[model samples]
Target: MHIQLVRHATLRVGYNGHILLVDPMLSQAGEMPATVNTPNQRPNPGVELPMSVEEVLDGVNAILITHTHMDHLDEAAVRQLPKHVPLFCQPPDREKLKNHGFEQVIVVEDDYEWEGIHFDRTGGRHGTGEIGEKMGPVSGFVLKARDGNEPTLYLTGDTIWCEEVEHALKSHQPDVVVPFAGAAQFLVGDPITMTKEDIVQLAQAAGNSQIFVAHMEVWNHCLLSRSELVEYVRANDLSDRIQIPQNGEKIEYQR
Candidate 1:
């Protein structure tokens, strides 16, 4: 299996003749507003799209939306994607996505099949305390193909490290794990996503799973930078298992 980190949380994952686009925020750089009030409050996507929308859209068989946040499911992505393409999302977001002109909105409550691959919605905690309640609901996915060659992949949605994340590690034991780790915060309250400390814990818990960290250096609210995270992983002796991919970079995995 291969997953391309197309800036922030957006990705193109291909396996077993199927290419699934996840959390597509296809807006051009500087088109969207800053996420929150902060020093890094320049624009939503600080960097431009590495490839054109046409390049990213090639070979896409379906769309898997983790949430309806502007950064995840923005206007550009909605208008660009084919209306008839299948959309897999959480139950809470089915209506909202349908209203956006998506023809097939499949809620990932149970296992949703695409061709031969199986997609199971995994639970996630977007934040903790009162902030979490206001952040709304979000869910991740555990995807595995029927063929033994494809390894199990867990894409943890916009979330902070919690029991649910650990449970997924212990239960599915995925070969490739993508966890959001920008420590994104607003003016007040704790970070809504995983911090360096949390990443350390997750690395320790994974045992041998490969981690490709996302949600960094994109939005104003995200406090972490690639350089900072790289140093943290190196200093903590977790660099061997973790990969901080560059924007538009791709990582291939085998079981």
Candidate 2:
């Protein structure tokens, strides 16, 4: 499997002869509005996509929507993606996607199979208490190769470190874990995504798996920088297990 971090939470995944576009917020820097109730208050996508829009869209067979947060599914991406492209999204966002003119928005509740690949929808807590509830529902996915030549993959959506996450790791034992480590926060509460400490905890349970993190620095709400995360990882002596990729960087794993 080849995973390319296009920008922020957006990724281009090439697995088993298919390309899945995950959380594609493909707008240019400042093309969208800023997130509500957050510091920095800057326009969305503080950084630009490392590759052009066309290059990123090329060969994309499907799209995964973790949530409808603008940072994850911006107007720009919706405009660019083919309406007929297969869209796998959480239950709540299914109708929203269809209204956006997408024809094949599939709501992945438990598990769904596409061609030969297997996708199991996993639960997540977007935040804590009221803030979390207000943030609405979110989900991650566990992708297993049909033939088992490639390693199993777990994509953790916008969620903090919690029991659900721990349980998923213990139950699935995915060889590749993609955790959103932006440490995003609103003005009223704790960070909604995994913080540096959260990543450390996840690393301990990851066994021999490699962790690839995205959703950092591109948006104003995401406070943790790659340098800061690197420092923490080094301090905790987890250099081998963690990877914080730059825009347009690709991290690949195979059996």
Candidate 3:
């Protein structure tokens, strides 16, 4: 399968005559407010999109929405997306998308199959107890295509280390796991997502599974640096299994 890291948590998964747009966040730089309540915010991404929102979305078949956050499922992307394209999301987010004018909305339960892919929905906690309670519920997805050569992929939406995520690793055995590892934080609370150390621990638990780390250096709340992460992984001898992609870079995987 071909996976393109669009930016932040957004990705494009291509295989079996399909291009699935996962969490399309196509807004211009600085269009939204800073996620961290701090002074001296960093500049938003100045890079131009590879293609126009309309052009990139042309002939897109479906959208996989992990959550309703603006960065993951923004108002601009939702408004620009074709109404006919089917959207797969958790039950609660389905109504939100449908109300926004998306014609086809599929509210996935624990598992579902569409076209030639099998999708498994797993629970995710945004953070530890008190932090998670404030941030609200989240989820992750494991997708397996019919083609035996294609690698099974796990997309860990915004989440922290938890039993459910570990259980998914044991059960699905994905060839590649994409985790949001920006180590994002707010003004008054602990990190609401996986930190770099968390990524290291997750990689250890995942054993040989390849990991693609995203969600860093793109927003204000996320503070971890890719260079530092690379150093940590290399020092820990995890360079072989971990990949840190730059924005708009594409990586292909086969089983």
Please tell me which predicted candidate would have the highest lDDT against the true structure.
2
Better of 2 and 3 by lDDT: 2
Between prediction 1 and prediction 2, the one with superior TM-score is 2
Return the TM-score for each candidate structure.
0.97, 0.98, 0.93
lDDT (C-alpha, whole model) for all candidates:
0.88, 0.91, 0.82
Residue-wise C-alpha lDDT for candidate 2, range 1-255, written one tens digit per residue: 999999988999998889999998988898877887788799978988888999999999999999998889999988899889899998989889999999999989899998788998888899899999998999999999888877899999999999999989998899999999889998888999999999999998888889999889999989999999999999999999899999899988977
lDDT of model 3 at position 137:
66
Instruction: List RMSD in Å for every model shown.
Output: 1.1, 0.9, 1.8
Candidate 1 vs candidate 2: the lDDT winner is 2
Name the runs in model 1 displaced over 4 angstroms.
37-39
- Superposition TM-score, candidate 3 onto the true structure: 0.93
Model 3: residue 250 alpha-carbon error in angstroms: 0.4
Regarding TM-score, does 1 or 3 come out ahead?
1
Taking the candidates one at a time, how many backbone clashes does each contain? 0, 0, 0
Models sorted by lDDT, best on top: 2, 1, 3
How many Å off is the CA of 56 in candidate 1?
0.6
Choose the strongest candidate by TM-score: 2
Please give the ranking of all candidate structures by TM-score, highest first, separated by commas: 2, 1, 3
